[model samples]
Target: MSTENAAVNFSELVNRNKQTLARLKESPRLLLHRRDGEDLVLTTAARAEQDQTVVSAATRMLASLARREPGGMELLLGILPDVFPWVRFLPEPDLHAFTVELVDTMRAADSLGNSASVAQLLITWQHTAEVHSDPELLAALTRDHAEDYGPATNPRDVA
Candidate 1:
């Protein structure tokens, strides 16, 4: 075994165990944040429901990744309808705008090849939206993303 071959083998071993390497290969733009005494995997439904801070942190990380990656926007946009299913039941301007922005960000992220981060963000957003029922907000979101939302029609008529 020559020095060069030995060095190459060592490098490969190091790369295999690194989390960043796995992320880069599996989902390059996805951001993973470490919390004190927190497990990366949520084993049960109760644990997932009880972990608000972890969920919020994950959301922020996704938002940050979308901001950093332009292609992630499309994925973000795709998430709106799925996250806010009750958008057809309420009337609120601010929530509507927020949902629109989130969708736009996803679209942008997707364009930039940040689909993984967008997916992660969507998961977090859906979970959060489910826990906090804002009828108006949900309705507004549904209205804003109606065109690209497949079966869901936009409540307002636009000419």
Candidate 2:
């Protein structure tokens, strides 16, 4: 089975059901593009399970490496720039914090079979990096305001 994901219009699958199933034989994974909604992924249950297993194993290995080796986390932090170029914008302390959070979140998310959480964490960190990368934004954010804003409200409470 080809490892590459093949994409086809959602209509193609709806109109040519048999042909689409045949395409699956050539490529184990398929991305169904939809005009009006979120795109859908199609793959065999076995393949999905295998992918989850691989991700889980990798997460466990990463956790183990960080725990067992001296200066292990530093080693991992050293490679963050390569994995995410935007991380270069983060200050040294923030960068270290991000790395620790990322590894922990990855391990937790993988264990729960919830990759979405990992993705959200990355997005949140990337946006933080973006702010740090912009000189004006960083200065504006860091500047002290004399104005006393009233009580702070918890975001969770608003919802």
Candidate 3:
């Protein structure tokens, strides 16, 4: 969607989901805003729970925004503690798909003038990609996952 549409849609969505939006606004780690278009997007400064009610709510809100704008959706999926568990369990193909979706959403958000969201997505993508590149951190994450989940069968495994 155009930046103008994104902004309008974002404002409308926030207004519609006032409660959840309010909670998100309260989060120090989240960047929620509307660009110029009818697009509404949420960008996270860090990873959040994929399965958390709030995250799910945000996702739903994004979906609604997409429907309203018909241009697409913008979302930044972070690799924070809450979301790691679910993302880790995703199959490789699924994980890649998720990444694609995230990148696309971020791009759309950026087009709409949501700098905070864009920055958050960039940070998250960098962190996740870097974490995989670093053997030490990867090993530590694996160990932690194993400790929490009773044996890490996959790098994506979460407790």
RMSD of each: 18.5, 3.0, 16.9
- TM-score for candidate 1, please give it: 0.26
Model 1, 53-119: lDDT tens digits are 4555565667766566776555554465566664433235534555556656655664554556657
Ranking by TM-score: 2, 3, 1
Candidate numbers sorted by lDDT from highest down: 2, 3, 1
Off by over 4 Å in 3: 1-95, 107-112, 144-159
Worst 10 residues of 3 by lDDT: 1-10
Instruction: Output the number of the TM-score-best candidate.
Output: 2
**Model 3 C-alpha lDDT per residue in residues 15-129, reported as the tens digit of each score:** 6766554545444332335465443346344433432445445645664554555444323233422554545544466456666666557446644544477467646655666
Model 2 residue runs over 4 Å out of place are 149-159
- In model 2, the Cα lDDT at residue 37 comes to 100
Question: Whole-model Cα lDDT per candidate?
Answer: 0.49, 0.91, 0.51
State the lDDT of candidate 2 residue by residue for 1-159, as single tens digits. 687989999999999999997888889788999999999999889988999999999998888888788988989988889999999999999999988888899889987899998899999999999999999999999899999999999999997
